[model samples]
Target: MVRKEKLDSMFNAFSIVSGGNYVYVCDMKQDLSRWSKSAVDYFGLPSEYMENAQSIWNEHLHPTDREYFNESINAIFAGSDNNHTLEYRARRLDGEYVVCVCQGVVIHDDDGKPEYFCGSIKNHDSVNYIDDVTNLRSLYGFLDDLKSAFWKKQELDILMIGVEEFSRTNDIFGYTFGNRALRKLGSLLLSEFRCEGQVYRMDGTKFAVIAQKSSIQRLSEIYADLQETCAKEFYVGSDRLTLSLCAGALHLERFSVSPDTVYSCLRFALHESKGNHHGELFEFQEVVIDESRNSLTRLNEIRNSIVDECVGFELYYQPVVDAKTEEMCGAEALIRWRNNDYGLVPPFLFVPILEQDSLFPELGKWILREAMICGNRIRAKYPNFVMNVNLSYAQLERTDFVDVVLDLLKATHFPAKNLCLELTERCRLLDVKLLQNIFVRLREEGVRIALDDFGTGFSSLGVLRKLPIDCVKIDRDYVLNIQSNKEDRNTVKFISQLAEAFNAELCVEGVETAEMRDMLRKFNVTSFQGFYYSRPVPIEEFCVKYSC
Candidate 1:
């Protein structure tokens, strides 16, 4: 009798604290002790209904939750552990089920056997388990949950964006500046998107926004505005910097049939944004989805190649001949892959894929090693011959790249002067100081540095003043129609004059026609390369033609 009195007091205290119902079930017997007035009101049970609480309560439980609720209660009563927590649906008098969370503790008898279970039940309608700001979930977790919730209600549109060469900016300006820039971008996005959606910082250099269900046209308009906003120059500590943003957007209703499928679709859109420049926005289209699927399939095959160390990759050498003497000066090493089943895949198709993965470093090392061996083989015949190898942004930024090159030269017993490292202008813009250091060290050892595709990127006159370079290869676009297009001719002439001012040899690429060649010659261009001389060919073929 005393125990029952104490239990009733405990129930009353709980009811007062929670402002809700409380129940104490003793050993699964049909009778329950101490029901609260709030419980009666919440369950919509009359005063008379309390006499037979078990039957009344059983009828109020949602059909879907009835079995689980009963099972959990039984388990709590049978176990020695005093705690039980569960979420289930409870039907109201109107036959509507409301979600509820129940927490309870089991009371033990003198012998340590379960005697009764006491618990409090609360309505969970106001609780948002997925999006409580104080919970401090990770960025990825937040994005996943946000995507799922919006997709579930069919109320989401997503945009993914990345700042181009984000790594380079971080390297040159330090992460402090990079982070501040990103934060400023985040603030801008929040101000612009908060009224219509939620913005999430997806990763170090990527961001995503979720908009309520909207038309494709509306999304496109917003995306264009966002592109414009992102393209504007930012001033980081008076260092005026212009960074490009590439964006991809998708409507939740397009490919996502369920909330869980939204993330995958968003990822597909994000991947499509790679290699795009500022103001470039790619919308989610059926073709993109198909291509993404195909690319993923190919990615698996590429992964296997890395594991086996048997990348069926081949090297093709494009001769860079002296324009005046018509003598082959050096060859640019090009890579091509031919799978047994897929046949030949172009470098443009697979190189980007490799760049996106960890395999790029290994593949770059292989290319360097193979090119050195082949170049040395030819050098054996012509001691003064040189070879140029293209390096990607990833390979060049590696701290050990200089060491790798020096080691390769020593191993091959080839003169460092016989190898030229060709980098695009964009690569130079990455970290002018670091690249200068690398180039300076290489130049000190007699290795030449050539700026490849000079006019295509952020052409900083400051770069020429800072770095020591031996040659500047004008991009093929400027040379393509120079003979016919006066603008192209003038651009080439202007670049040629600048090269002369810098005391750098100017090599014009893609000189296919005699007229283009003559134009380059007239502009005082010294070196040239294109199909007119020879397309990239096998080492054996190149050696047979160029060997002295």
Candidate 2:
């Protein structure tokens, strides 16, 4: 303890720079701590300088967070980690609980043993909500603060950074590790923009920065530095990894709309950053606001159309042909929407928005009923033919879903054997047990189940094995490049073999040419569906074109 004066001098520095935050220094060996007045008063501590400050602080912790806080403190004292960062709820003097972020580091002596702990605490209220996972401001907080700043007319620049391949990381390392890595990244971002702005942890591997009085040019420069930092490998515990980040930025002053509108534009920019720009920064342009969104007015149109008996909605059928005889064996029902204003709007434009929508179940029921009605017409000619209709998670989640399907089949006078319910790629989100039960119930009635967009999404083989599948429809991504992509061809062959092993027939989608058909036919696929067979047409047109 010969350098006692040096320790005192360092502690004195915190007094000068508390910056309206709670600053504290703990003498680990002595079990004493000195807190700034704000911390003492807010936390309702008995004294500014006191023994057992940790226990005193612990007493004020929210009941739900007390155990976690105690465990972390014990680990810190045991010298398990070099950094001390925690987020927890603490009771305030006003009898209110506030989410507080505590950040500090363990100061080691010459012997490399823990000697002191120093930190600051920032209380985040509703105006600056906090994320429990990362301890950063959450997207809700981002919107809250953005609205406040916007109303005040404070010029602001918003920057969004999305982590690439985060899902793959979670799949490999598990969600517990993914959450820790996100926390580490959040702290890194805090350090990067501490003096300049507020950083937020947005939903799903995306982070946002909102700096008052900042410009796009300045934010762009900041993003470059952040991108460079992320390129270098970082560690959460002993695990090391490098992250690729794509960025999107919006200058709020450039638009006169609400904060939500501004965020919508920024989201579009981030999508471009990931899909087209390969992690480069994509800025929101005024022209894109109109062209890309076509206005979210479509969301309104969808709701209204669903209410009006699905007025603008239509279903088109594309044939799935037999590999051996080239006869039309089945058809996939594809949904179409045609508004008077937009005229033939793409499914990609509205389907995604409505997939989780409350009205989707209603719309989904409409598609199934219509497909069954039309399938009845087709089955009159082709008795053994199958009519495939895509299923959505929204529809599947309903308790009445299985009942709806059975009722539609009976009401339409359609044979269950002639209809196949193809599970869309998103159905991967459902629990395996739930999916199995649904598939089994449908199969009990002789209705077929096909896993749509096979060889894509999480656990393709696993899904095929777990579910009672009658068919596996290969995704267009694989079939489109089967001619040149060796990996694609190998994947198709592997899936085909796997399907056969599971006693499931294989159908290849995106067969736009005869060569593709010949190539895929060599791989044990029984059916093909694509432009080569025929683009999806009206049900009447399908009957006339593929008539027996």
Candidate 3:
């Protein structure tokens, strides 16, 4: 509970605020109400301080609105409410009925009953701070206060609350009902805080409470209560059910930071809560290590893109042509991320960093489903064309990976035989037994498997002997210099011979110039993928350049 002096300090702070509002305060113990000078002048009140204020206010309420006003106030004095908010018509000094929006919060005593109530009354014409649906302050209002607190360099703590599976709510009961549910949630949060000073309806089915007066520890306690309140049956309009809530919090002690940075970190924290914490509150920690901080921030952005429906990340297809026909036979789907700040980021730069991240499996699934669906479209042009996707170790280890793959194939209606999953040297780190099991299962479903960067891993020979792969993608290193270096030529010769022994097709990578392509022909390479044919491109461009 906020002490009387603190609430009084807050009321005084608002009384001098620039916004056009008529502030009011109520001492629940004394049953006395105090109106600001503006409110007294506008209402033509008998005095600034009124005895039996409720009865007096009730007398001035528009006749038709008397019932609602009485009930709302009755709820407050009865200790049934921690916050008060309503809209109604009230008769003014000129005897004109004016629509007014009243929003106030109850500051509690030790027993959690309202000790004081401080709120503002504003005319309907100036409601920019209020959210139409929730009646709590809008995101605009939240941002305005956030900026104000930030620029003032005050110590701040903020909680970003999101309803898990809220779209399902909309699906169950149309969006109109979902909005009502959201309003109920907003009111619940506002009540838990027992104040209208900070709680706000954020954009996109989320809520926020930014506080300079509350400590991080206090916010945590409040969040725990909010979570508990959601666990019980929460009535929304008429329907009642439990709401799943997740929150991300940040505590900043100093003012030497940017709100934009805080906003990103807080959002990242929320994403972490939803994705990894099972709806638990996650607090963004300031990293002391420079390298770790940069890495963390970079990965956060990448993960954010993935969560945003795989935005900024796209598949680029590189055509693989049969060496003899010198025509495209298949295409390898490579991913490229075009970050807003960094532009087109190369795959090597982002993929390696993400391969170890837990979210990589999700991104990997996106890549596979996207590649398969796109490849399915291309099969219309050429029935035998294959689409190859590289499997990250992160994806390979997911327990549901095989099931996910098979399900995607069925859903996308892409032929399993037209798809190939490639494994790089990193896949060597996974258990050989697991790799063998996955390879066999996929092969049984008519999906081909290939060892990418075949000669790059330390255990290249071991992987070839143990894993059942249909193709050996010779590392680009050997092919890059085959025309000039005898060792490169010999290495290509050795890999080709090994492919023959393993009965796997040999696809030499990095066959850049015509000279290199021709030089590689001596080694009995079955396919070639390099700039000489085409660099990786979008699905539409791939079809155009390698048209059937």
Superposed by TM-score, candidate 1 places the C-alpha of residue 79 at a distance from the truth, in angstroms, of: 40
CA-lDDT, candidates in order: 0.69, 0.81, 0.79
Q: Return the lDDT, model 1, position 191.
A: 72
Q: Can you give the TM-score per candidate against the true fold?
A: 0.58, 0.53, 0.50
Per-residue alpha-carbon lDDT of candidate 2 for residues 1-548, written as tens digits (9 for 90 to 100) = 64455556656887677666688888888877778887777768898778888888998988867876787788888889766666777898998887777877788888988888887887776444679998898887787677556435677878998998888779999999999989999999898777679999988999999988667888788778888877786788887878899988877653234555566557667867876698889986533335434344555566678879999999999999998889998998999998777778767766754664567899999999999888878888889989899988889888889999999988988889999999987666577888888889999999999888886664466777788999988889887888888999999999898889999999888889988988887789898889998999998798889773
lDDT of 1: 0.69
Predict model 2's lDDT versus the native. Answer: 0.81
Model 2 regions lying over 4 Å from their true place:
1-293
Point out the higher-scoring one by TM-score: 1 or 3: 1
lDDT of 3: 0.79
Please identify which of the two predictions, 1 or 2, would achieve the higher TM-score against the true structure. Answer: 1
Q: Say which prediction, candidate 1 or candidate 3, comes out ahead on lDDT.
A: 3
Q: What TM-score should be assigned to candidate 1?
A: 0.58
Looking at model 3, report the run of 10 residues with the lowest lDDT sum: 287-296
Which ten-residue region of model 2 has the weakest summed lDDT? 286-295
Summarize candidate 3's per-residue lDDT along 90-118 as a digit string, tens digits: 77788876667688888887987678877
